[model samples]
Target: MHTTALVLFSGGQDSTTCLAQALSKYERVETLGFDYGQRHHIEMDTRRVVLANLRERFPQWAPHMGEDHVLTLAALQQLGGSSLTDEVAFAMQADGLPNTFVPGRNLLFLTLAGALAYRRGLQVIVTGVCETDFSGYPDCRDDTMKAMQIALSLGLERRLLIETPLMWIDKADTWALAHSLGGQALVDLIIEDTHTCYLGDRVHRNAWGYGCGTCPACELRQRGWARYSARDANASSSP
Candidate 1:
């Protein structure tokens, strides 16, 4: 078991769940976020609020939560082509990948995270990347994660483990995992506080969370909520 962990937290639903899990399992867990010039800056904006709430709401995990690091990587905007790094409208490319696919976002995030984890003497790096029910981002694949873990350990000259708790789970299962980890309080915290809309639209709120309810992220989240709620309803009616 790893004693120390650094979560690649984005203040979104997935990352927040990962953070909660890290806090529960690790003796010490820190968070690392990147300012990659994303068009939707709400995720970055809400990081502090989420952390504060975690400390306030979950006393058990509060002692384990440690330092938070935010790195500014302006180079992403400089190398812009994707919708996230650019001012272009979101669309599907001829190659079938969404315009929101920032070419090297996850790869770059993991590399910087490895460097920071090495400096911080962290034993594990936790991330929210998922292969199932994701937008087909190749970087989120289990194979990609496995390869990155090997590469980071080799390059950093440290025995580092990359933990992807959400790797094989879809969004509904993700909600179920959160409920298992921290129960209804956590589920409520995630729905009310987490931000996942690509547009950073917090003006509109839904049963699942605050989002635009149309973007890929919002759609996935809403779909997951539907399934999760259905299961809950069925379970309640069980004999």
Candidate 2:
């Protein structure tokens, strides 16, 4: 009997790392993606590619089993507020949550994922939410996740574990862990392949991927990349 796990996959750096980690741990790993009508449709495409590659690598893992994780794209488009789904321009908030916060997004996604996991008899669900590098999203915090876990258990009548492997890890540490786990190839694939910009820009200039590097997301990404590259270079140069 395989231990199945559901991954709340976003096809981004953290989520992709979580996917790889889940692959290493669970006998059967399933993914759940949302078409939350994000401004960047590129993410959805990236998710498809990630899934395809996973299937190519792990032929025994059923590729993408279960129902299509695609939710109602129109409803999300209709619901505004978050920059990801709405026409609102992204603004970098120096403090507090930003416009990118999709209200109740993770809650809804996890609730659906919980249902899926329960249906598949899987007790574990994995997500890539991080508190360290997270952009002040309330749902990314540990407390929020704990509360959601309780709510899910009570409301859904299912005992499921929402595993957040990168909840406390910063981006630099995430890169280090990926390098340590023979996931350098995967990391490179994601860095070069997936899109993470709140503005949907995807070109690395001055060691920045996605976004204009001037934005908060880009600033953090640039810092993380610099740290990782410098450490990796120093390690290589050392005798």
Give the winner by lDDT.
1
Q: How good is model 1 by TM-score?
A: 0.98
Worst 10 residues of 2 by lDDT: 59-68
Candidate 1 C-alpha lDDT tens digits along 134-223: 988888889999999999999989988999999988899999999999999999999988899988998998999999999888999999
Q: Give the whole-model CA lDDT for all candidates, comma-separated.
A: 0.91, 0.73
TM-score of 2: 0.86
| Residue 135 error, candidate 2, Å | 1.5
Clashes of each: 0, 0
Candidate 2 per-residue lDDT over residues 1-239, each given as its tens digit:
34778888877777777877777777777778888677777788877877676556545444434333665546656778677777767775556778787778888888888877777777788998888987888888899888888888888787778889999888888777766644566666666655566666655444534566665566777788888889889989999
